[model samples]
Target: MKITTIETFVLGERQLLVRIGTDVGLAGWGDATLEHRPGTVAAAIREMSGHLIGTDPLPVTRHWQRLARGGFYRGGPVLGSAVAGLDIALWDLRGRFYGAPIHELLGGPCRDRVRLYTHALSARPEHTGEPDRARALVAAGYTLVKAAISGPVGFLDSPRQTARFVRDLEALREAVGDEADFGIDLHGRVSPHHARRLADAVAHTGPAFLEEPLRPEHSRLIGQLTATTSIPIATGERLYSREEFLPVLQAGIAIAQPDLAHAGGITEVFRIATLAESFDVQVAPHCPLGPVALAACVQVDLAVPNFYAQEHVIDLRSADSRDLRLLTGPEVLVPVAGHLDRPTGPGLGIEIDEDAVRAAHRDDLLVPRGTPRWSHPDGGFAEW
Candidate 1:
C-alpha cells in the first residue's frame, strides 16, 4: 500500500514520535527523538516526508537509501535520526504486512532473548546512596548496571575529583559483587589524560566497560587511551554511522554502542553490527529515549550475533513502568530478569495509544523548551 500521510508528535519533554499512515488504513510508528533537538528533528521529518507520501511503504531498504543518501550532504545526527524515524516505521509497516516481527524478516532470531542493562546512579559524581541504588538494581534482577562519572569534569581536575570518581565506581562494584557487571559512563566530558587516569584507577573494579571516555571529535585519541588501560572502551551514541564508527573499531574498542535512533535505525545499525563483527567488537545499542526506539533496538539485538546488551532508562516490568505508558501490547518489551524474550507480534511488536500520544503532544505545545546551556566553575562553556 502507498503511504498516505506522515505525521510527527512531540511528546513529553524530549520525545519526537513519527507516524506513517498508509492507504490500507494501517499506521506505523517510530521515534525520531534527538534529545534536546526535538524541534529540529521534527522539522527534518516534515521536510523528509515529501519523499515518502504516496510511495510504496513496503520497500524499506530502497526508501532507506533514498532518504539517507538522497541528500547531497549525506549524514549527521539530524538526517540520520530523521531517516531513522521513517525507516523504522517502514519496517514496522513491512512487518505488519507480512505478519512477522522485524527480526524474523532480518533473518530470524540469533538468540532467544535480548539482555539489558540500566543506569544506577545520577550523572553527577556523588557516593551518597550509590551502593544502595546498585543493590536495588541488582535486586531487581538486572545483572548489568551503569552510571556516569560526573557532570562537566574540568580539563584537569584535582586529585579529589579522581578519587571520588573511583570511589563511586568502587561502591557500585562492591554492591553488585562479582556476579554482576558495573559499567562506567564517561559521557564524553573527560579529557584523554584524565580519562586514562580514571580508567587506570577504576580498572581494579573490573568495570563492564568505560563508555565515551572522550568526545566524538577525539575518536583518534581513543586508541591511545585504550592502550593505556585494560578496561574495554565503548562509544558511539554520537558517532551516527558505520563510516564514522570504522576508525574507532580499528582502534580496538572492545564494544560499539550505536543508538538505533541516531545510527540510521534498523537498516544502518544492522550494517554497523556486521562491520563491528568483522573487527570482533560487540554491539550494545545506546537507548535512553522512548519505548519505540527501545523496541527497535530489541529487534536488531535479537538478530545480530555479536549483540552484547541493551541500555534503557526504565525497566517496564518493574514498579517504575513509565515505559509501558501510552502503548498497547508493551508486554513484548517487559523484561524477564533483565532479558526481553523474542516478540512474536508483527511490526515493531507494540502499538501506540494515539489518544494518549495526542494528549502528551498537546501538553508539550503548552510548554516548549530550548537547548540547555551549562558552564564550568571558571565560567567557560561546558558540555551538557
Candidate 2:
C-alpha cells in the first residue's frame, strides 16, 4: 500500500509525533521530538512529506536514502530527527505488514529481554537526595540508574564544586550499594579539565559510564578523557550520523549511545551498532523522549547482540505518568527487574492513544528558542 498522508501531531507538550497513514486502515507512528527545536523537526517533516505521500512504503531503505541524501543539504539535528521519526514509522509499517516485531524484521532477537536504566536529573551539587531517588528506582525493579550533575562547570572547577560532585557520587554509590549500577551524565556542561578531574574523582564509585562529559564538538577531547579515565565514555546522542561516530569508535571509546530519534532511526543506528561492535564497543540506545521513541529504541536494543542497557525517562515512580497515558489500550511495555520483555506484538508494539494525544495537543507555540545560553559566576558565557 502507498502512503496516503503524512501528518505530524504535537503530542503532549514537548513531543512531536509523525503519523504516516496508508490508504488501508493501518498507520504507523514515530516520534521526532527535538526537545528544544520540536518546531523545526515538524517543518522538516512537512517539507519531506512531499516525497513520501502517495509512495510505496515497502522499500524503506530506498525511502531512507531519498529522504536523507535526496536533499541538497543533509545531516543536521532538525533533518535527522525528522528523518528519524519517518524512518521508524516506515519500519513499523513493514513489521505490521508482516505481522512481526521490528526486531524480528532486523534479524530476530539477540536476547529475550532488554535491560533498562532510569535517568534522574538534578541541578544542585549538594543534593544528596539522589540516593533516595536511586533507592526508589531500585525498588521499582531497576538495577541501573543515571543521575545528572547539572552544575555550571567552568574551565576550572573549584575545590568546593569538586567536593560537591564527590558527595553526590558518594551518596549515589552508597545508596545503590552493590545492588545496582550507577551512571553520571555530565550533560556536556563541563569543561575538558573539569571532566577529567571529575571522572578521576569519581573513579572509586565505579560508575557504569560518564555520559557526554564534553560536547560532541569536543570529541577529540572525549577520546583524551576516555584515555585518562578508567570509566567508560558514552556519547553520540548529538552525533547525527555514522561518519561522525567513526572517530569516537576509533578513539577506543567504550560505549556508543546513539539516539534512535536523532541518529537516523533504526536503519542507521543498526549500522552504527555493527560498526561499534568491531571496536569492542557496546551499544546503548539513547532515548529520553516519549513512548514511541522508547519503543523504537527497545526494538534496536533486542536486535543487536552487543546492546547494553536502554535509557528510560518514564519513571513509574515519577509524579507524571505521561508515558503510560500517551499509549492506548493495556500497556504491554513495562520493565520488570530492570529488564523489558521482548515485545511480541507486531510493529513497534505500543499503540498510540490518538484521543488523549488530541486532547493534550496545541498549536505550535511559534516562539523562538534559539540555543541554550548560560553564564559563569565571573560573567563569561559557559557551555550548557
Task: Report each candidate's C-alpha RMSD, comma-separated, in the order given.
Answer: 1.8, 2.0
| Candidate 2: segments with Cα more than 4 A from true spot | 123-129, 317-320, 368-373
User: Which numbered prediction scores highest in TM-score against the true structure?
Assistant: 1
Candidates in order have lDDT scores of 0.86, 0.84
lDDT of 2 by residue, 1-384 (tens): 889988887754457888888998788888887876767788899999988999989799999999999989999788999999999999989888999999999999999998889875554544523777788788878888998776567687788878888888888888888878888888888888888888888899899999888888888777778889999998888998989899999987888999889888889999999999999999998888878899999999989989989998865433246567877643466666778888888889877777787676657543445556878888888776
Q: What is the lDDT of candidate 2?
A: 0.84
Across residues 1-384, which tens digit of lDDT does each residue of candidate 1 receive?
Answer: 899999988885557898999999888889888887777888888989989999989888999988999888979999989999998989998999999999999999999998889878763434422678788878878899888766668888788877887777778888999999888888888889988888888899899899999999999999998788899999999999989999999999999999888789899999999999999999999999989999999999989999999999855764247767878766777788888888888988888888888777843442466556778988998876
TM-score to native of every candidate shown: 0.96, 0.95
Backbone clashes for every candidate come to 0, 0
